[model samples]
Target chain A: MAGLLRRDMLGVALTVAAIMLPVAGAQAADPIKVGVTITQSPPGSVVQGTQVKDGLEVAAKIINDAGGVDGRKIELVIEDTQGLPEKARAAVEKLATRDKVVAITGEHQSSAALAGIEVAHRYKIPYINTNGWSDVIREKGYPEVFNPGNYNSRVGAAAAATMKELGVKRVVSIAENTDYGIGLAKAIGEALKKIAPDVQYKYETLDRASKDFLPAILPMRANAPDAIINLMLPPAAYIMMNQLYEQGVAPSAKTWLYDGSGLADYPDFWQNVKEAGKGMLVFGLYHPKMAQPALGKQVGEAYTAKTKNEPNRLLFQAADSLFLIADAIKRAKSTDSGALIKALGETKYTGTRGEITFSKDKGYAFNQWLDVPYVTFQLTEVNQKVGDSALVSQAGQPLDPAKLWKPAK
Target chain B: MSGIDVDLAVNGLITGVFYALMAIGLSLIFGILKIVNFAHGEFYMVGAYAYTLIALALGVPVWIALPLAFVVGALLGWLTERTLMRPLYAGYTSWGLMRDEYAVIVTFGLSLFLINFVDKVIGPYAYRGPPLVETSRVVLGPVLISGHRLLAAGIAIAVIAVTAALIKWSFWGQQIRAVSQNRLGASLAGIDTAKASVIVFMLSGGLAAFAGALLSPVINASPDVGIFPAIKSYIIVVLGGMGSVPGAIIASLFLGVIESFGAVYISFQYRDAFGLILLMLFLLFRPQGLFGEKGREV
Candidate 1:
């Protein structure tokens, strides 16, 4: 009787061990899903979307090649928002519930980002803003949302400082009718008021849909400002720049053409602007001359090798976005939403650009990678590459006016 | 007037010429079908792409490419009428039997399809057309205009004159007018009413496409490039008295000058608003429009 009882106990223990081990193994091997929302069609900036998509894909490949995080692959579930607010909201909802992604990232447009964050907050999912520069995104103070790219206030201060250094008393910003464009335009105005009190500044908001801006541009001919700042995205920015050049408005000896939209890095810049881009000062987010981590070089080289086009700032920002998510997952040791959010908040990961860490402070600084580096450069010749352009200002440094160029009328 | 005002007026008139070209086609479509072609903008977009690609990509001369673009647009217009638009008036003996709602739904759907088709196939990139002239800048008294724009405006005037003449005096022109006035009566009088409808669509398509090709140099061609022009065309069609080609021409010029001057004197931001205000004022006071006759036939 005693031997029979011992045999029954041994058999039950063996059965339990066999069932539990395989379940744990399957869980460990399952891929972790991340969500990406970007514009892939018209009425939105497709160029930005294509760049971000390429960047994320490159980073995903790098991670998988490095055996991924804890031996599980990072799978991206992408949705095309077309840069519409309603589309973005639905995309986040689908990503969180249907795709069951651990986190959401790669939103480049500010208006889309604003809509996306609401859904992320509702679902308590982690959202990393890749390129949406509007300060209002960070100002909302949503715990789930984080920004690791450039912000409007940063640009506003930088632009104000540059204007002061150039000693331009009168400035005009031809802004596109969008959150990013108008926000930066207003931010610059505020910054100018504080830092360069004597400088005269005003901004004209143009409909993004309207192709003709001659009316707004022609009036400036009679009383041309000292500097004309572009606060619009291409191809609208390209159109505006060409129109400005055609009207003898800027890049001339008397007036400087300052690009606040970081338009120089776009692949189609020279193709669209041609001679109009010459002698223009650019607010560059990623210059080839700037110091970056080894990962940055890897991603940039991979992007060029794949696309056969030079790397832009959006690539590094997008790569860093994905890397931050993967790093958070590894640190948390789980794919649970609460754990992922907590891990992301406490992240201090070395990414493609630099050692990225979220800020604990409130307002625009909260959960933002505050020290995103930038540089100022000048396009001295038509069809000049961003790498070949002269860097007039380095990260955290003032612009050197002597290094700048203006076309002689 | 100051030099700036003179410059504004000159630019306004030039713009008006292009607007007249676009509006004439839309007016013709409305006159014949009594339903506005919602896809009128896509026709323009197609022409812009055709001209740009033919000249820059295929190494064709600008003069040759310009006419070829119009031909392409005319062919597209003909095809659209033969296929999608035929169902609206097919087998229907009278205007009252026609499903007017079908025209709206089909044209709107067609517009969306064409925009997306171009976007996907051609990719969402803007291609700047080659300039008709090599000179970059041309000084015209008080204004500094680009050589391409000045030349394009000249071509636009000639095209408008030719189109107007064709509609007024040509053999096909008289048939189109007769059909537009009374489709059933024109059919009864031995005029092939369907053929006249086809010609109107072709002419409308050709003119709109020509306008697009002309402006491609200034406004780079993208997928949805026709949206703004299409909206303006709607307003112009109404302002000019729905079906009057000459009225369209005059209204186009008037709106252009008002917008140009209003943008400068009143507010640049409200430049579009000025046109809307005019439209509202006209709708309230003169519902029949500048040239449109009062009352609709049941």
Candidate 2:
């Protein structure tokens, strides 16, 4: 009886192996799908969305060209969120449930990212935040969420340090009323309090949808601050800058205009602002003159060739997002959510920008890349390209005020 | 008054001039059809693109480009009326019952289509039209304004005056007023009501487009650039009295000044809220508006 039972168990084990091996082989041949949520329509930052989409496409191409991850090609399933939170939530739901993407990434708006992460967390999918800078996103502390791009706290510290070096007594930030804008504004204030406690700082929130900002700008004419930081995105930023110039506010001899929103690298910056952009200082994530990794150089060249436009920070941030996902898949050796999450946490891969590693620390540092490189530059002339702009400061260097330019009032 | 006050007033008035240009068209549409043209803003957007692309891409002079924008808007207005709007009043017996709903849906759909069409076709990047003047700043006492803004404001006044004159005296304008007053009566009196409707739409489109072309330098032309101006125009039309041209002009200036002062004294964040508050109050207490008759029948 014992010999008969042993033979039966052996026969069942052999049958299971025969059934599972072919299914596993077939699955390995299928492409790995990654989900992207971005604004492709009006009322959102379509410019930023387009740049991110282009970067992701370039990265996917490069990955596939290098024989892909274990012979499986990368496929991206994209959805237009139009930069709305509700739409983003629905998009993530659809992608995770219907499309069955392994990992979700490429969200540029903070509100959208915040909404998307909830669904991603619920489904236990790995979520790489591309460019949502709000600190609240980090504070949520979801195990599934990882940030390899810039954050509001990082920019706030940078802006404060630059303001201190410039020796500005009074500074004002004209921030748009959004999670990214308001969070960055508050971050700047907190950083200023630590670095330069005596520096008078305040932020005014403006409606992003409103075209005319003269009313918000007009009062500043009577008492212009030593430095005015622009925390709004275009074309609202462009409108505000023009109005400020017309009202003789900032970028003048008495006041310094600094852009913390990385507006200098936008393709439409010069055409939209024209003379108003001259003499403005910009906080940038990517500069042509800045030293970058070889991967960064390749991505930048590919982006320029593809779009006939200059490489921007969004392009690099977005590329890094995709590369990190591919790297995780390769390390994990499986498309399973738990395995991918574990691999991503342990990642120490060098990406397009630089070495990226997710922080296990709590609060804003949780799952965040803490040491992203940045630079300060000045647009010295009208229609000045980001490459041609004066790089006043590079990563780990103090902003040089002498390198700055002021408009003759 | 303080220098800021002087600056605010001048800026407000200048802003009001542009608002009047947008609101007048909306008012005209409301007068004839008794239904708002939700796509009225797209007319303005089309004009902006027409003026900017004509001048920048085609190398046309800014002066010619500006008027050409108006003509383009008029043509769009004509097309919209002939193709989409004609179904409401022209021989469709079942459609007459759903005229108001049909107008709303059609116009709203047109607005979305135009915005996305422009976004996909022309690309999402914004383009600033060349200013009419090169002078950046022109200071008059405490008021320091941009040369282009001051010039544009002057042109807006002239256009508004001419539009008012034509509407008050022109033969076509009289026919339009007749149709707006009583569509059934006007048709019975051999007023050629369809012709009047077409003319109103064309004129409405032209004015809104002219405003867009004039302000493109200041606002920068983008796909959703028309949305804000459209909202403001709606508020102005209601405050000034629906379908009243003079009321729209007066209400626009009033709202602009109120916003300017309120932004400084009350709160800059609530500046836009002031218009909405006024709109709400008007709807609740006086829905007839400042110049609108409460109820009129043939």
Candidate 3:
């Protein structure tokens, strides 16, 4: 009886070993999967998503061309977030659990990023934030999340500095009713208090979906402020600017139209706001005059060649996100999530933007690469490209107020 | 008060004129159909896209694009009536048996479908329609306004006036009024109630689209742009006494002025809330509205 049982156990063990051999061999040869969540449809900013997707694809191609990481191809598993938080959460869950991606990336909006990171945290997956600017995303202190994109605090400080340089006493911000908009508005107010204590700061939260902003802008006509800061995205932002211009409010000799939301780089910026965009000061994240890494130039050229449009800061940031993930995968030598997360923590790769390195500090600095390059540029003429615009400042340099031009009344 | 007060009032009135153009058609539809067409905003969206795309893509002049938008909207209205709305009125013997709940659900679904369809097909980027005039800004005494806005307002007034006149004296207008007064009685009197409903829908769709096309230069064309205007139209429809064209015009102007003044004096944040608060008060106190006649059921 004992001999017969031993023979049966040996036969079952041999069958299992035969099955495991092929599975193990296939696992070794399988591709490394990276998850990307982006808004490809309405209610979300599809423009931002399309740019990010292009940048990511370019970076992936670059990586794949030079012999994929450790003999395994980098596979991008994309899911559409539709710019909604609930949808983002579900996309992340599907990517993490169903697809078994090594890392999650390509979230553009802050609200969507905020929701996605929660699921990434649950599964201990590394999430490379593409363009979400809210500080709350960092404040969460999730170990698995990393932000290579711009932050609201940085933009707020830059805006406050510009306002102080311009010597504007009263400032009003027309912010979209969103986490990114409200956070940046508050950050700007706080920064202003520290630098220009006498400046009066206030912001009006407008619905992003609403077309009519005359009701909101008309009230400001009575006592237009010294400066008007736009902290909203396109379409809505363009409408608001036009209405303000039509009302003879901002961009006039009295009030300065300062854009901290980087509207000048948008492809439709000139087409939408022809007259209103002139004499506007823009807080730009990328300028052609600024020093660029070889990777950035390559991606920019590729992007321009494909879309026939000038490459913006988002393209560079998005490209760097994918590049960094690929670099980590190469360094880790495996597609295992644990290995990728550890390698991302020690990321030392130079991406299209700069030498990307995740910080060890907590809060907003957690896994964030500090000293991301930025510049301030002014749109001196209508339909002027970002490359042709006058660079007022570069990467922590003070903007020369004397170089700025004001409109003639 | 300073000169800014006069500027604000003029600007507010001009905006009120545009709102009235959108609301009057919705009011007419509610008067006859007795159901709020939630898809009313999509009609505006469709018109804006039609005018902008036709002018920009096909290189059609703004003059031609404006009327073309109206025709497109009218066609959409006709299609909506023939397909979705027919289920509500066709083969129904009694008004009590009419399925209003189903109409609301179907129209709401249509609104969602149209918005998503446009977003997917045209891409999500907002397109600013070409202006009628190249003039950017014009200063008239104390008031300053955009040339496009002034031109659009003038067109809106003319359209509203013509629409009002048509509804007042035209043969089809009287038939529509008769149907709204008593659907069963009008049917008994050989007034094809279904045909009257179809005409009302076409007029409603055309007016909403015209408003959208006129404002495309100022607002830009987007998928969800109609949502706000649609909400405003609903409020104006109720405040203006459901089916009363004159009442809608008055209510739209009143709401616009109130919003403009309240935004400045009170809080710009609560600008949208003022309309809702007024709507609540009207519903509580004057359910029949300013011009709606009280009705009794047998």
TM-score each candidate.
Answer: 0.96, 0.96, 0.93
Model 1, A133-240: lDDT tens per residue? 999999999999988999998899888999999999999988988899899999999999999999999999998887878888898988999998999987777778
lDDT of 2 by residue, A290-336 (tens): 87899999999999899999899999999999999999999998899
lDDT of 3 by residue, A1-409 (tens): 9999999999999999999999988876688788999988777888888889888888887777877776667788999998999999999999999998889999999999999999999999989999999989998988788888899988998999999988888999999989899999999999999999999999989877766687687667768899999999988899999989888888998999999898898887887898899989999989999898898999999898888889998899988998888887778876667888899989888888888888888777777887788888899999999999888887667877778888888
Residue range B29-132, candidate 1, lDDT tens digits: 99988898999999999999999999989999999999999998999899999999987898765688899888999999999999989988987778888889
Badly placed stretches (over 4 Å) of model 3 are: A1-22, A334-338, B293-298
Worst 10 residues of 2 chain A by lDDT: A400-409
Tell me model 2's lDDT, rounded to 2 decimals.
Answer: 0.92
TM, chain A, every candidate: 0.96, 0.95, 0.93
Specify the CAPRI tier of model 2: high
Instruction: Enumerate residue pairs that collide in model 1.
Output: none
Model 1 Cα shift for residue A294 (angstroms): 1.0
**What's the lDDT for all of these models?**
0.90, 0.92, 0.88
Clash pairs detected, candidate 2: none
Q: Residue B240 of candidate 2: its Cα lDDT?
A: 87
Order by lDDT, highest first: 2, 1, 3
